[model samples]
Target: MKKIKITILFLALLQTFSAVAQSSKIKNLENQREQIKKEIIEINNLLSSNKKEKNLTFRDLEILAAKINIKERLIKINNDQINLLNADIKSNEIKSEELKLENENVRKDYASMIFNSYKSRLKESRIMFLLSSSTFLEAFKRSQYFSQFSDDRKKYSNKILKNLTSLDSINKILKDKIVNKEDLIKSNNAEKRDLSNERNNKNNALSSLKRKENAYKRQINQKQRQADLLDKEIDKLIKEAIRLSNENKKSSTFSLTPEAKALAESFTKNKGNLPWPVERGAIIQKFGLQPHPVVRTTKIKSNGIVIATTKDANVRSVFEGVVLSILKFKGSNLTVLIKHGNYISAYKNLSKVFVEKGDNIDALQIIGEAYTNINDNKTTLQFSIFNNTTPLDPYLWIAK
Candidate 1:
């Protein structure tokens, strides 16, 4: 009876642990799904709206491709979640069977013990055994044995009660799990529907855009030239800033100042942990080479990053650095660049600039407010990182 009780207890603990693990996994998957849904909505809005001015140009196709790649990853995650649920359901079913078996064994043991106790009491068997002892020592020993037997019987009774309680709990859990499993199935079916719709939209959009291949190619070339020109101007400004910074360091060598050096080292060490330039925004465009989002056949390349945010959002520095340049480009908006050692970060599409060239700024310091498009009221900041003349993806450096 003791061994049976121990087994039941162990099974109960195992089932509890399993349930908690499954619950945690489900929660994590739900969070990931929400984030993916948000990104997909943003993409859909971009496609449907007349925000083309703030939209990804042919040169920004690489960013759009990365966004699509993220969607693919989300789909794979959903599949994995469904597989996990299936496995959990199977495991729970096996555990429920084991619990039922243990409960039956407990009931049988309890009934047998109660019957044996009743039979012994009716026959006066325990008292007779003690009375028939040949000596005082023998009688005492017999009494002790009987006392132990009664204690054992009581312990068995308690165990039976506990087993019943555990059985009730386990049964409830099983019922609840069935409901949860059904909900998971429904969620997966809904996700599949959304996935299908998104895929169909992507296909239709690609087909429609391909009809203007020549015009799309021309637009791509023009956008590429604009990006190249911006790249050149940014590179030149960064070099000049670096030269000036070095000169200042040389002039201040007598003071043995190490603050700038330490800050620079700190910035380098946190390569992939840098904060976003804007307080709250999403990456509407990514870095690297990829096919255009709208002009399907044409590939768009980007030298930097494009982050979309709420209207009138403030742009801030990811790290402490000196203000390199604040330029008004094409009479549109302001662009602020900051230099940290050999690396330079640019923040563009600002309506107002707070820091001037040569001004020192700290990490997360608001440098300027981003400009909002008059039509859709969507604010976007064009961010870029450069090591000398080579452009690097700001996304890789920023914290997710």
Candidate 2:
């Protein structure tokens, strides 16, 4: 029965667009920041375990560099949250001011009506007003008028009360927003401190690494040859698989059954949404060419992403497909290839194989345990997905 609803309709309509959009954007950013923070913690723990090594290995530099990258991103996210909270605080302050003005106007009107009502009641008592009517019908109309007038006054009074309540609610919300913004500022400052510490550690690591230039170059060269060999072997095995698939058919690539074709379609549809090959690993090496994280002049290229994990971590299948072949490099163990119609996913550097070459595997199924190198005291998985013999960047298909 309060006209406050009508008065505030415009304000409500104006906020509709930003309400969900701003809240959800902030929530999404916060979630991402938390995930990256957890990853930094994991990487820190992993790197700390290797601190007792006689030398600061290139792998150590890589891990430290990765941590620095995440820390930088984390700081950026914190700043973004603070910016968002500031915008929200400003928006709420404006809305609160509007509500205050509206409340004031409503109170003025209610007070005027109350004053006028008292004057009328004093000038003409209800019984006197009713008896003053010339006829019975007129007296009955007069009584109805008085009743309606009382109801109108009560309704306006209620409106004023409702407006006051809304103003109070707005004030409360503004206070809460101010408090939240303060909390965010504190968090942002704390992250900035942590970032500073990481940067210092990075500088120390870089200085130590620069002292062993030749040793570092040798490590880089060795790793590059291994990667090149792995790539060659992967190409060879996948080409053979495609050849076998096309052996009986006129198709240049694999001739698929209807079900296999459908499965491939589904897998393609889930690009950027596919599960990661390993549950708990950070992508130590990314797809495509980039300057090495530690060695600025040196370039590193990867057809697929390399995920570093705990020793003997589970290497899971990204999609359901039949295993094609399990090949091995000289040092690294078996690498399993799975075929889903025209698409193939490769999981390399595996220590122990779980499924056979011809076994039917489901999505997220554990294909093998990643290799643990006693020399470096590390475990890593080189995961690649292919469309026939052509390599695809594994990062594109995997979930964030």
Candidate 3:
């Protein structure tokens, strides 16, 4: 009986641990779902409602594509949640069965114990039991036996109550989980419907883009040329800054002062924890090379990530730094570079600038307004990070 009780306790602990683990995973997936949903809303806000599919431009197509992609991911998260709930339900059902079996065995043992105790009670009164003992030690042993029997009965009674309570709790959990699973299924179905509509919209936009394939190709080429020019200029400026900093030094990197070295070390330690350039936005384009969403055969190269935000959103510094330079050229609105020791962060496509060269800036200080294209009515900020002259992916540096 003791061994059986120990076994049941072990199983109960194991089940508790499993439930906690499963709950943690479900919570993590829920967090991811909420973040994706928020991003979809931000992207939708950036999209121009006035533009019909027939008038959709390349940037419009990209926004729609991004929204659709995120919606699919939300649906996938819902599916994962449903799968986990199903597993939980199954586990609970199995555990409930085991508890029921254990309870029955315990009740039987308890019933037998009560019946035997009743027979013994009828056979002798407590006074008669003690008087009938052959000696003092025998009488003491009999008293102990009676006390132990009573304690055992009480222990078994408590065990029965605990088992019943456990069964009730498991049943409640099962019922709640079933309801949750049903709700998730309904939610997934609704998301699927929305996803279907988004796909249709994207397809219509793609059709419009395909109709003017050659014209759009020229437009893409022109945009790429501008982007390439801006990248080259930024690279040249970074190199010049490095050369001036290392004028008398033998090393190729910046010669930092004690204070600057400490700041650099702090920045390095926060590689993945830096704030976003804009307070509210979603990344529409990532760094590096990738194929165009509409034009699969054509490749697009990006030196930095592009964040689509509301019109005239404030662009802020991700970390404390000094204003390195402000740049402007045709097709590329305005670019501001902030230097943090050997690392530099660049903010491009701004309609205004609030800081100047040699100006000391604090983390999250408003630098300028993100450029809003009047023609497309879309606002976007181009943000880049570089370790001296080498470009780093801003996505890796920014906080998720």
Candidate 4:
């Protein structure tokens, strides 16, 4: 019986630690869910702002798709939380039943102990037991037996109380977990309904876009031409900067000073942890060749990701660098190129420029405001990173 009690205690301790770990996991999931919820709200605001147009455009459809994606993620997190709660509830239920059975056995033992003590009292008192002893040795032994019997009665009483308290606590935890699970299930179901409606809206928009496929194709081609121009301009400027850095020698890269080299090393080491150019935004266009969101047949290649943000959101520098050049192109906003040794980060599509050429800039320093198109009511930041002249995906470098 003592071994059984010890085993139960060990199991209880293990369960306590396991509960703490499980609680941590649930907390992490809740944090992620909250962040995703905020993103959904941002996307909804973007959609609301674009509602000024009489009909939905490809941009509207893109925002809707993003919303649906985030909504699904939120629901998945909710399901995960619910699953954890279910496991906890099941474990608690098993423990409660075990406690109930143990308590029953203890109650039975206490009853038997009380009945035996009563019968002993009826036969002879403890004082009489000592007086009736035939010798001093026997009296001492009888006294010890009476003391042990009293201790045993107290131990049984305390055990019963402890078991009852533990059972009550477990029952309370089970009730709370069940209620939490039900709430999560209700939330998940509501999100699913919203997700279904968004999908329908996206499908309707896609159908409308298909009705004007040829026009969209032309627009895609025109956009590609503009991108090509921007790419060439960026490359030319980088080459020119390299030429100036290596004036006495012929090289295709910048001749880095010790300070510049250290900066570049730090920048390379901080990959995937770089800050965003815009404070609050979502990547609408990803890097590299992907089928156009609207016209799948028309492939669009991007050297960097395009972030859609609030109107006139300020664009910041991702790292410390010297502004290499301030450039502008026809039918496009201004571009600022900052050189971190041989690595170059470019922020384009600015309505207003803050820093000038040769100016030193720090990370998160505001450089310009993102241009907001009045026609579509969309504001986007075009961000790119390059190693010498080779284009690297901005999405890979920026924090998720």
Q: Which portions of model 1 show Cα errors greater than 4 Å?
A: 1-24, 40-75, 135-141, 170-174, 202-211, 221-281, 295-304, 310-313, 318-334, 338-345, 349-352, 358-365, 371-379, 384-400
Q: Local distance difference test, per candidate?
A: 0.71, 0.83, 0.88, 0.89
Number of the candidate with higher lDDT, 2 or 3: 3
Ranking of all predicted structures according to TM-score, beginning with the best and ending with the worst: 3, 2, 4, 1
TM-score of each: 0.67, 0.83, 0.85, 0.75
Model 3 scores worst on lDDT over the 10 consecutive residues at 48-57
Candidate 4 clashing pairs, residues 3+ apart or interchain: none
lDDT tens string, model 4, 318-337?
Answer: 99999999999876789999
- Where in model 2 is the C-alpha error above 4 Å? 1-14, 130-148, 225-229, 232-256, 265-275, 329-333, 387-400
Tens-digit lDDT track for model 1 on 158-211? 776776777677567667757766775676677667667666655654555556
Query: What range of 10 consecutive residues in model 4 has the weakest lDDT sum?
Result: 290-299
Task: For model 1, give the 10-residue run with minimal summed lDDT.
Answer: 248-257
Model 3's TM-score against the true structure: 0.85
In candidate 3, how many Å is residue 23 off?
2.4
Per-residue CA lDDT of model 2 for 1-400, tens digit only, reads 3688876886777678777799898898888888787788788777877787777777877887888778778878877887887888788778778877876887787788788879988998889989999999999999898898889778877877786787688678778878877887887788778778877987887787687877887777778888888889888777776666678454446777899899989989999888988888777777888888888788888878878898789989999999988887885568898998789998888889999988999999998999988877888888998888778998788876
Which is the better candidate, 1 or 3, if ranked by TM-score? 3
Ranking, lDDT, top scorer first: 4, 3, 2, 1
